[model samples]
Every structure is written in C-alpha cells, then in structure tokens.
Target: MSPHAELVSRLRAAWLSGKTRPMEYRLAQLEALGRFLDEKKQDILEATAADMRKPPFEVEVSELSICRSELNHTLNNLGAWMKDKHVEKNWATQLDSAFIRKDPYGVVLIIGPWNYPINLLLVPLIGAIAAGNCVVMKPSEITRNVERLVAETLPRYLDEDCFAVVTAGVEETTRLLENKFDYIFFTGSPSVGRIVMTAAAKHLTPVTLELGGKNPCYVSDSCNVQNVARRVAWGRFFNAGQTCVAPDYVLCSVEMQEKLLPALREAITEFYSPNPRESPDFGRIVGDRQFQRVQALLHSGHTAIGGQTDAGERYIAPTVLVEVQQDDPVMQEEIFGPILPILTVASVDDAIAFINARERPLVLYVFSSRKEVVKRVLERTSSGGFCANDTIMHMTIPSLPFGGIGQSGLGRYHGRSSFETFSHQRSALLRGAGRETLNTPRYPPYAPHRLPLLRAATETKRRATCLLL
Candidate 1:
C-alpha cells in the first residue's frame, strides 16, 4: 500500500482507540513537540538550507523563530484555550447555565507549503494538537530535505498514534484525501487549493486554506520615497520573494516608479551589496523549477535594471522591470521571485482602481502620509488585511488574521485564530421548569385573546432585551 494510505490507516486506528481523548496526554505531546524542535534546531536549519539554499540567519528568523514562538504560545495558552467557556444566560434560560464547548474535529490533515516549510507545517500542528485532534501532516514534497526531516523527526518525538507526517507528491496526496478526515488545513497556491477544497467537499470536511494572491504595494507622492524604497525592497526581495504575502507588484506614478527605482537599487546595495550573488545576505530561488519560472517572467518584459541570471546557481539578481504593461504575464501571476514589476499609474485613485479590479489580495500596502488618502484607499479596496506606509509587516503581527479572500483563498489562522480554526465551538444550553411558561403559548388552541398576549410577549424591539434557551 502507499505510504500516505498507510499513514491514514494508522491515524484512523489511533482515533478508534481513543488515543486523543486525554487532555494531559495531548498537552504532554505538544510540550514534547516543542522540546523536540528545540533539540533539533540545527538539523532543522540544515534541512531548510539544503532545500532552498536559504541562509542560516533566515532559517532562524523566518522559520525557526516563528515555529518556536508559536509552539511557546500554544504551550503557554493551551490550558486556557482548552477550558470550556461560560456564556451569559438570558432570562429564558437563566435557570440553566449557557456555555460554549469547544470540541475537536477528529483526525485532521495539514498540508504544508514549500515556502517557510517548518513554520507552515508546525503552526497548524500546534493548533490541531492544542485542540486535542490527531494530525496527519503532509509537508510539501518540493522541499525534499525539509520533508525528509519532518517525516523522520516528528514521529520520534510525537506519539505516532496522535501525530504523524506524510511526505509525498500529487499522487500520494490524491490517495491521502480519499480517506476522510474531520478537518484539513492547507497552505499553497489558489489552483491547488481548489482541488483540496473539492476533495474536502466530498467528505464535508471543514478546511482552512492559507493561500496566496497578487499582493500589491501602492506608493504615493506624500511619503519619503527613500524610506518607502527601503521597506518595499526588503519585503519584496526577502526570502528571495518566495513569501506568500510578499508584495507581488507595485502600482505608482511613472515619475514615482522612476524615483523609487534608484532608491530601491541603493537599498538593495545596502542590504546585500552590489554583488548580491556573493553576499551572504541574499538568497537564491528555491529550486530549478521555481528558478526557471522566475527567469521566464524576466524575459516577458522590458527590464529597467539588473536583469541578470545564473540558472546553475539558481540565482536571479534583484530585478526592476519598467514599461511593464498590465497584460504582461509577470503582472498577471504571483511573481514569486526577486523580480519586482512596477506598474505606473496616474494617481493614488488610479492605483486604487487597478487594485480593486483584480482578485482581492491577501495584504494591501499603501505608503503615504496623507490620512485622507489612506482612509479613501481603506474604504475603497477589500483585502484580507492591509498595512499603511509598509509592506508585508501586517503578517508579522500574530494578532491579525492572515489569509486570502475570493480567488486568492479563504479562512484565516494565526494565534487565537488557529485555535478557533481547529476546534468547533458547540453552543449548548440547559433549561429548567421555570422557563416552561414560555413553551405553553406554542400549544395552539387558536383564540383572539391569546393573539394579543403572544404579540406582546414575542414582539422584538430595537431597544428591548431578549432571552434565549
């Protein structure tokens, strides 16, 4: 049998045996998982570097830090997050306690993505574990080293009955989805997300999709163009532009694009030196396939500056493309590489119109000091979230909901959102005989006197307080 199928069967058997029932055991497993990650920090970094040529420092800051912090957050908050919540009762049900019980959706599946592999996989795992659900984690096969590390390392530290990692490509994923899971958390492209959702619909399994979109950065005339260039350059080229929330493209006036490009070049030189390939601060495209994809996008347009490539090293220089039309392929898709396509527009209003025309992005960034212009953009455009005078910084805050909308993707997860995603809040109420007075009116013995009384009692008003059962 296939490895994915076997893993599913093992998880199913574990669920049947009730291995996920004990809260103490679940918490222990979570703590162990964190400890295991801490113990194997070097191994995680090595594997990530092997997969993407990612720098050691980046592995620490982007992947490991997020993983450790989230695990820590879960460890510190799990008990409280798991505690049953008491809700206020209304007069109709005042005799009984009204509470919200958060129950696990058993046997969850987590499909992790290639970018930030460890963090993407483990964040959802923390949620599923905290919510008391057995998890089947599928690390992205594109990142082979990290996938191997996860499949090998996770089982050693976690209870095989409660948490297991399945590593495979599309065929195995096809087979894995055949067996029903109560919940699935997927992070990837919009194209694959649709397939995941379609398969999930067959089982009616609840899903949380963390997907990507053509995230836009809008530069205005009011801001400091140099500072704007610095932040935008950092966000665009960070992770080799492989981040899902990376500013996919920029919209600004032709004059502004010209103004920003020189500053951006300066910023790039400051961050990674003029020879970025030789600089330790810069990273390469993830793999051959991604390298080729980004390289092809470079050929699609007029390159204003730094159109350099080395396929053998999987390196593309920090690129700036000008005279880029909206119809260009680079502008059409999520340019998940170091290429920054600058689309020139007349004004901020024109930029807003351009943004509103496309699928709503995951995060919208507007760099401007004018409060009225910022407010106008905020009121006009719809995104999963937005950041003012910045790019991709909103994602760093754990309090904000991070997920796409419409064609970009669906559902949000991070911090408390992650806990809520994995657990179903079941509303339950207990009532006593005193509330029985409310029930007698429904035993219809049609009469005129009863109509007036029923209308007076049941009529809902804007200023009236209501009770429930």
Candidate 2:
C-alpha cells in the first residue's frame, strides 16, 4: 500500500481500537496540543517570519494565541460537549428515553490555508480531537518553514497512531484527497473548496469549507470618520491584508469617501509611519506569485495613499485606491494582499444595492452611529457575519459561530460550534421491553376505532401539558 493509504489505515486502526474515544484520552491530547503551542512559541514566531516576514507580535497574537485559546477552551468543555444531550419528546415518545449521542466520525482530514497556517490548522484539529476522531493534517506547503516545523514537531506532542501531519504541495494534496475520510475540514479559496467537496462526494464524505470572499465594508455618513478609518485600516492591513475575512473593498457615499480618505491617510501614517515598507510591524506578501498578483492590482484605481513595491522583498505598501470602478480587476476577486479599494455610491440604499450585486461576502461591516442605519443594512443584506461600526471583531467571540453563507463558504466552527461540527449527533431512543403496550399504536393491524384513539392521544395542541406514559 502507498504511504498515505498506510497512514490512514494506521489511524483508522487506532480509532477502531477505541483509544481516542475516552474523555480522559481526549483531554490528554488537548493538553498536549496546548503544551505544544506554549513550548514552541519562539519556533512558531521564527518560522512564520521566515515564511512571510510575518511580525513576531502578529504571529503571537493571530496564530499562537488563537490556537492556545481554542485548545484551552476545548479542554475545559470537552466533557460537557461529549455528554449525551437529552432532547424533549412528544407524547408519542414519552415512554422512551430520547437523546443525541455525540459520536466521532472515525477519522478526519484537515487541509489548512497558507495564511494563519498554524491557527487555521490547529484550531480545527482541537475540535476533531475533542470529538474523539483520528486526524491527518495537511498543512499548506506554500508556508514551508511553518509547515516543516509542524510536520516535525507536532507529531511528537500527539499520538503518532492517532494523528499525523503530511507536508506536500499540489500534487500530493490532490492524491491525499483521493482517499476516504469520515470528515474533511478545508480552509482556502472557493475554487479549491469546490474541488474538495467534489472529491468528498465520491466517498459520500462530509466536509466543512472555510473559504474566502470579497468582504465589503460600508461606511455611512452618520459615523465617526476618524474611528472608522482606524478600525478599517487595522482590519484591512492586518497580516498584510491576507486574512480571509479582511474587508476586500469599501462602499460609501462620495461625501463619506472624501472625509474617509484624509482620515485613512492619517491612520495609515500613525499605524505604519511615513514609510510602511520599512516598518517591522508590517508584513510582506507571502511569495513572488502573490506579490505579482497584488502588484497588478495597484494599477486598478488611482492610488490615493501608499503604493510602493519591492520585488526582492515581496513588499507591497499598505495601499488605498479611490475612484475604483465596480468591474475593475481589483474589485473582481478577493484581494489577498495589502490593497484596499473604495468605491463611491450615492446613498445607503445604493451601497446596499452595490453589495447585493456581488457575491455574498464572508463578512459585512457597517460604520455608523445610528442604530437604525446599521439595522437597515443588517436587515437587507446576507453575509457569513456582520459587524456594526467595527471590523473582524465578530469572529473574536467564541460563543458566536464563524462561517460564510452562499458563495463565501460552508459550515462553521469555534467554541461549541467547532465541537458540534466534528461530531455527529446520533439520535437515540431507549425503552423498556415492558413498553410493548405503548408501542402497539405504531404497529400495523390498524382498526378504525383504534385510529381515532391513537390520533387523539398523539395529537398536539396549541396549549398542552406533557402526558405521562
């Protein structure tokens, strides 16, 4: 057998042996993952910096800290999340005990993206572990340093029989997806998401796709321009704007655009200084291909602010483009770099229409002080998540589910949502053998008189009390 097949067989054997199903075992794995994060903080920081010139502080906050939080949260709540959830039943099922048993889908495959490699990969691994499933993690090969670190060090902290990291590029990933898995969790582009879903369909396997979109930021005239500029700049330029949920473009009135431009310029200067390319806090494009793609976009609209580039360093300055047309190349796809485009609209209704005309975004942001204006936008549009007067903060709350709608992506994971995503809620009904009389109504051999009596007994009322068996 091939190495990948053999590896999957080994994990399946471990899962079948029931080693990963125990609560104690799950807790141990989660704790080990937490320790892995804590022990390898410096290594992770250095690797990310090597991969993308990612700032050490940014790596710590966005990558290591987030993974640690997910691990800790899973550890604290694994038992409760794993417990059988009892569900209410009607009079028909009152005689039987009905509950949802959280069952792990034997073995899982997690394919992570290059951006935020560690966090995106490990966070879902935490869920798969908490759900008591064996995992095969495929870290993106584009981030070679981080991928190598994970492939070498991560297995030492995990049970080799239950978890393994496979490092490969496109060819290997395509082959790896050919194998059968109980579940697949992938985070990347929508085009690749379709490929993963298609491959999973062959095995009738389930999948969770955390894909990307051109997230829209709508700035209404009723809000604070300075605050809006600061928040928008932070969200748009964080990780050099490689985040999947980063605001792809801004939609606002011409008046608001005029006010926002100067405020945004000031915010950019305050955040990254006059020369952002030289700022240590700022990150570079991940590779030459990405650099070239973003370089081509700088010509889309008139550059209002920073528009510097260095091919050797893969540096694209934190740039803002104004007077952008809707059909421009920059507006066409998810600008996965440090480029922010602002498109002018006439009014709030026009902004909503402009957003609605495009694909559904992963996130929609509205900067407005008026609750009614925010409410109007929220009511009209659909997105994976929404933030009023802010950006990217909605995803920070673990209690809220994080996933896209329609074209953006499918499924959600974070906190309980993560655990639930990796779990199959098996509906169970248990009853005593002596309850034969109660089940008589459901059996065949129907009589006319019995039909009326059964209907009356099982029929639901507008205002009804629970009936005793």
Candidate 3:
C-alpha cells in the first residue's frame, strides 16, 4: 500500500480500537495540543516570518494566540459538549429516554490554507480531537517553513497512531482526497472548495469549506470619517490584506468618498508612517506570483494614496484606489492583498442594491451611527457575518459561528460549532421492555379506531389524556 493509504489505515485501526473514544484520552490529546503550542512559540513565529515575512507580533496575535484560545476553550468545555443531551419529546416518547449522542465521525481530514497556516490547520484539529476522532492534517505546501515545522514537530506532541500530518502540493492533495474519510474540513478558495466537495462526493463524505469572497464595506454619511477610515484601513491592510474576510472594496456616496479619502490618507500615515515598505509591522506578499497579481491591480483605478511596489522584496504599499468602476479587474475577484478600491454610490439604498447584486460575501461591514441605517442594511443583504461599525471583529468572538453562505463557502467551525461540525448527533431512544402496550399503536394491526386515536394523540393539542383511552 502507498504511504498515504498506510497512514489512513493506521489511524483507522487506532480509532477502531476505541482508544480515541474515552473522555480521558480526548482530554489528554487536547492538553498535549496545548503543550505543543506553548513549547513551539518561538519556532512558530520564526517559521511564519520565513514563509511570508509576517511580523512576529502579527504571528503571535493572529496565529499562536488564536490557537491557544481555541485549545483552552475546548479543554474547559469538552465534557459539557460531549455529554448526552436530553431532548424533549411527545407524549408517546415521554416514557422513553430520548437524547442526542454526540458521536465522533471515525476519521477526519483537514486541509489548511497558506495565509494563516498554523491557525487554520490546528484550530480544526482541536475540534476533531474534542469530538474524539482521528485526524490527518494536510498543511498548505505554499507555506513551506511552517508546513515543515508542523509536519516534523506536531506529531511528537500528538499520538502518532491517531494523528498524522501530510505535507505536499496539488498532486499529493488530489491523491489524498481520493481516499475515504468520515469528514473533511478545508479552508481556501471557492474554486478549490468545489474540487474538495466533488472528491468527497465519491465517498459520500461530508465537508466544511471556509472559502473566500469579495467582502464589501459600506460607509454611510452618518458616521465619523476618521474612525471609519481607521477601522477599514486596519482590517484591509492587516496581514498585508491577505485576509479572507478583509473588506475587498468600499461602497459609499460620492460625498462620503470625498470625506473618507483624506481621512484614509491620514490613517495610513498614522498606521504605517510615510514609507510603509520600511515599517516592520507591515508584511510583504507571500510569493512572486501573488506579488505580480496584486501589481497588476494597482493600475485598475486612479491611485489616491500609497501606490508603491518592489518586485525584489515582494512589497506592495498599503494602497487605496478611488473612482473605481464595478467591472474593473480589481473589483472582479477577492483582492487578497493590500489594495482597497472605493466605488461611489448615490445613497445607502444604492449601496445595498450594488452589494445584493454581487456574490454573497464572507463578511459585510456597514459603518453608520444611526441604528436605523445599520438595521436597514442588516435586514436587506445576506452574508456569512456582519459588523455594524467595525471590520473583522465579528470573527473574534468564539460564540458566533464563522462560515460562509451560498458561493462564499459552506458549513461553520469556531467554538461549539466546531465540535458539533465534527460530531454526528445520533438520536437515541431507550425504553423498558414492559412498554409493549404503549407501542401497539405503531404496530400494523388493521383497526380503524386505532388510527383516529393515534392521530389525536400525536396531533398538536394541550390535553392528550383523552386520546390515550
């Protein structure tokens, strides 16, 4: 057998042996994952910096800290999440114990994205562990340094028999997807999400796709321009704007656009100084291909502020474009870089119409002081998540489920949602053998009187005592 097949077989064997089912084993694995994060803090920071020139502070906050929080949250709530939950039932089922059993899908496959490699990979792994399933993690090959770090170092902290990390590019990933798995969790582009879902269809496997889209930020005139610009600029330029939920473009009135331009220039200068390329907090493009793609977009609209590029260092300045049209190339796809385009709309209604006309975004931001204006936008459009005045802050809360709608992506995973995504809620009903008389109505005995009695008993009503007779 091939190495990949053998690895899957080994994990399947371990799962079949019931080693991963016990609460003790699950807790130990979660604790070990925590230890892995804590022990490899420096290594993770260095690796991410090597792979993408990501600043150490950004790596610590966005990558390491998020994973640690997820691990800690899972540890604290694993028992409560795993416990069999009793569900209310009808009168007929009241005599029986009806509860939902959170059963783990035997083995899971997790495919991580390159942007935030460690967090994307390990966070899902935490959920699979909490759900008591064996896992095979495929870290993105594009982020070579961090991929090597995880493939080499993570297994030592986890049970080799129950968890494995496979490092490869497209060819290997295609082959890996051919194999059967109980569940698959993938975070990447929508085009690739389609491929993952197609492959899983062969085995009838379930999948959760955390894909990307053109997230829209609508700025109303009823808000503070400087505050709005600061929030939007930070969200748009964080990680050099490689974020999936980053505001892809801004939609506002021409008046608001005029006000926002100066404020944005001020915010950019305050955040990254006059020469942003020299700022240590700023990051470069991940590779030459990404650099070239983003470089082509700088020519889309008239550059309002900060349009600088360096091919050798893979640097693109935190840029903002004004007078952009709806059909421009930059407006076409998810601009996974530090390029923010502003398209002018006549009014808030026009902005909502423009947003509703395009593909549903992973996130929608509406900046306004008026509650009614925010309420109007929220009630009209559909998105994976929404933030009234801020950007990318909705995802920080663990209680809110994070996922996409329609083409943006499918399924969600973040706190209890993550555990539930990896689990199958098996409906369980237990009753005494002496309850044979109560079950007679469900048995096939040709009796007209029984039909009326059964229908009346099961129908929606306050009193069911008469039907029982």
In terms of lDDT, which candidate is strongest?
A: 3
Model 3 stretches astray by more than 4 angstroms: 460-469
Off by over 4 Å in 1: 1-6, 16-23, 88-90, 433-439, 444-461, 464-469
RMSD of 1: 3.5
How do the residues 211-325 of candidate 2 rate in per-residue lDDT, one tens digit apiece?
9799999899888899999999999999999999889999998899999999999999999999998789999899999899989999997999989999999999999999898
lDDT of 2 at 318: 93
lDDT of each: 0.84, 0.91, 0.92
For every model shown, what is its TM-score relative to the native structure? 0.93, 0.97, 0.97
Stretches off by above 4 angstroms in model 2 are 457-459, 464-469
Q: Return the lDDT, model 1, position 438.
A: 79
Kindly report the root-mean-square deviation of model 3 from the true structure over all alpha carbons. 3.3
Write one digit per residue (lDDT tens) for candidate 3, span 1-469. 8888888989999999999999999999999998999899999989988988899988888898888888888888888999999987777767789999999999899999999999999999999999999999999998899999999999999999999999989999999998899999999999999999999999999999999899999999999999999999999999999999899999998999989999999999998899999999999899999899999999898999989999999999999998888788999889999999999998989999999999999999999999999999999999999998999887677778899999899999988999999999999998778967877886886677788778765666766556555
Give the better candidate number (1 or 2) by lDDT.
2
Worst 10 residues of 2 by lDDT: 452-461
Whole-model lDDT, candidate 1? Answer: 0.84
